[model samples]
Target: MKNLLIIILAALLYTIATGNTAAQEMGDKEKMKIFTNWIGRWEGEGSMQMGPGEPRKSKVDERVEAKLDGMVLLVEGVGKAQDASKQEIVVHHALAVLSYDKNTEQYKFRSYLKDGRSTDAWIKPTGENTFQWGFDIPGRGKTRYSIVLDPVKKTWDETGEFSQDGNTWMKFFSMHLTKTE
Candidate 1:
């Protein structure tokens, strides 16, 4: 009788553990579907601060490709000011590679430049197609990044900004991305 009670208790423990593991696995898989539509080619325009009086507005072309490894995505693009002549101004270039975390339901963005420096940020989703992400770098200061996605119209708006105090954010530039084949 004692051995039988021990066996029953062991079986119950095994069942509970298996059930919990299965539930966690399904939750991770469910998260992958939430970010599916963001994978594609897009183009956008926005403004950036060049100096106290010189605010430069530019257009960026980005292509987001989804990798099969754990809901990861890579964003690569180039940006240039609308009115600046290549000879008169230095090139403002950016390359970003980022990944999504299913457990945290967040996106981690890291951007590398030609100068060999990189900036990392954490992105949080606030709405169905909207997200806010920001971070501070050595020289760039505190920056806030936000994105708004319109699935029905297949459009997206993105903004990047810097805050002196980190509480109030000012927009340096905004981009309207339209999906094109």
Candidate 2:
């Protein structure tokens, strides 16, 4: 009777350990799929509000790819628009990495710009097809960026907004992207 009890306990422990390992692997793969959907070259048009004047129209291109065995997504974006004076074309470049955090159970974003500016934001899933990344801007309130993916249309729509009171949002930029490959 004692031998049988020991064998049963050992079997239960093995099952529990293997089950948790399998679940964790499956969870990671599922999370990876969410980011892999954005992997491809995208071209689009966008507009940005740089100053007090009107928003300037711009040409935008972005590329996203899975890295680190699908553990992270690397994104690169370029925007070309006329300057405030409309005298020359202004180019803006940015790079970003999106990764899932197991401890936080959420995704994190780290972005770097050509002007040597960088931002770290937390990502939230707002809807079935939409995700929002946001950060507090100290005295400026908050800034949020949202992206909606349309799988059927193979398009990505993104918007940037700022809120002084955290209740009223003012849009400052918008982009519409179509997958190129």
Candidate 3:
């Protein structure tokens, strides 16, 4: 009876240890939950500097969704603004995917633009409700975008900054959105 009790205790201890290890091994799905508040439809206005000229204003729409069994977030955005003749035209259109890489233990952001410009960048979670993503341009400069979602107010604010010397930054873009759904 004493030997049997010892074996049972050892088995229980081993099971508990393995269970804790498994629980602590976070997967991609768990990491993706950081974007939960961003999973919705949003509409608002945005502006971006096109040149040394003034920034153009436009109405923007964003749809964020969870795909691949919640392992990735698919983000689609469209911006419409009036042309010189006051005709509504597409100012910007983009599709992006956000995913957490288990191997790298980091988030990846890939964006596709209407102008055939695409970028594969890194995304860092700044807080429970914020994410910043960007990439470095070899000869030009680096551009970074930061997005903050206010769950209480159901608002999303994003800003874009560019740096040429890795120190001084210029704010070139901004978007203010309200959750529509």
Candidate 4:
């Protein structure tokens, strides 16, 4: 009976040590579910300041999918607009991967643009249906981006802003999108 008690105590101690690890893994998966609402094909329209000129009208389309068993989000976006001459269609494409970093307790966003520009940003949830992500630009300012999901309206709104003082923000662009899939 003493031997059986010793074996049971050892098993109990092992479970106590390993159970927390399992719980943490489950927590990570649950945290990733915050982005499930964004998984779909979306279409939208917006305007952007391409240069020193006025904001030009643009048509935008995006596709977001949950990959790696819902551990990562893959996003593809395309924007098209008529050039100033109105004789050609200007197109821009961007791809992004968003994933959670368990070690840092933050979401990491990596994006690549057709113009060969790439950026890495840290993401965090700001509201029940909203998340904000961005990075600091040296010598310029900090650029931040946000996405708000409205499930009731089946719509998504995204915006970008720049802050010269890290407090006063100036809006740069915004897009309103409707879920197609």
Candidate 5:
């Protein structure tokens, strides 16, 4: 009985120590440039291909703030239809962000919707001013977003793709945003 108790205690200690190490590593900050440039106010218009014959347009407002706690960044965003009827037809959408882990060296995107569900994304820069972010949904589907920022034009281009086979991509939404003062 004493030997069994010692074995169990050792296993518990091993698990706890491994878990703590992983958590500590995740909290470190790594990517700095990506977070700094993304900090600002942005506004744009977006369109979604709901179906072959169904398409919708909406306005997008995004705000990114630098967090004082280490290398963390906060983001807030809202999307609403321009037309009253369209607005009434669909559900409200909004997002609140806490912090981004720089140690992972990946752009992390998350949003809390009005429907009480939260979505998260991991992003990576593909080019100088281009980045890709993707999210996975358990039973529904997965979406990958590509964004491009033009400093001279002060505009942003975004495209969203949905995948089923994980390799095939289909356009789900597209947006063009102009920076707002």
Candidate 6:
């Protein structure tokens, strides 16, 4: 009876000591750590031009979260602005997902607009906390967005640019956001 109890206690201790080692070994992707500072709720202001129209001012709200056991970063943003009739309306709404592909060793970005448009684009870290992501349209040319994250200041500045020849670029969108949570 004593020997059996000792064996049982030893097995229990071993199990406790090695708890979830497989999961720990296959932990979150190290590359995704670059986006840690961006995981939060943010609010700010922004301006955008539609077609050839003037820029419209809007209030921006963004929420970024890590999901799927840290396999992906999900981002959602909404912009509210006054229309020409002076009525507040949803000017922009977008949701995006960022993930790292271990096999290809590349980052994949998928962004969707409120109007049922979506684009799968390439995304990569440009600097310590800066990243660029974008896709090319069939005929409209190429559109790219760059985001600079200042973790110290908890500020996020993003810009959108378009290029026709993939050389000459024009800026058409921008936003400045501060982390609120």
Q: Which one is best on lDDT?
A: 3
Worst 10 residues of 2 by lDDT: 81-90
lDDT of each: 0.73, 0.87, 0.91, 0.88, 0.73, 0.90
**Candidate 1 TM-score, true structure as reference:** 0.72
lDDT tens digits, residue span 1-181, model 6: 9999999999998897787654543553677888888899999999887687778889999999999878799999999998779889998999999988767778899999999999999998898999998899998899999999999999999999999888998998999999999
Worst 10-residue stretch by lDDT in candidate 3? 20-29
How do the residues 11-93 of candidate 5 rate in per-residue lDDT, one tens digit apiece?
Answer: 99999999988776545544545555566788988788867886777778877777764356676767777565544333346
lDDT of 3 by residue, 1-181 (tens): 9999999999999999998766645455788888989899999999999579889999999999999878899999999999989999998999999988767788889999999999999888897798888999889999999999999999999999999988999999999999998
Residue 25 shift from truth in candidate 4, angstroms: 3.1
Model 2: per-residue Cα lDDT over 2-96, one tens digit each: 99999999999999999998898678768867666588999999888966997877889899988877888999999887666875464779999
Count of clashes in candidate 1: 3
Pick the winner on TM-score between candidates 3 and 4. 3
* Model 5 spans > 4 angstroms off: 1-30, 82-92, 96-107
Clash list (residue pairs), candidate 3: none
Clashing pairs in 1: 46-174, 47-172, 47-173
Two-way TM-score contest, 5 vs 6, winner: 6
What TM-score, over all chains together, does every model reach? Answer: 0.72, 0.81, 0.84, 0.83, 0.71, 0.83
Candidate 4 wrong stretches, greater than 4 Å: 1-22, 50-52, 84-90
What digit string (tens of lDDT, one per residue) describes model 4 on residues 57-164? 688889999988788899999888877687647476899999888998888899999889999988888988898999988898899889999988989999989898
Residue 64 accuracy (lDDT) in model 1: 78
- lDDT-sorted candidate list, best first: 3, 6, 4, 2, 5, 1
How far is 65's C-alpha from truth in model 1 (Å)?
0.5
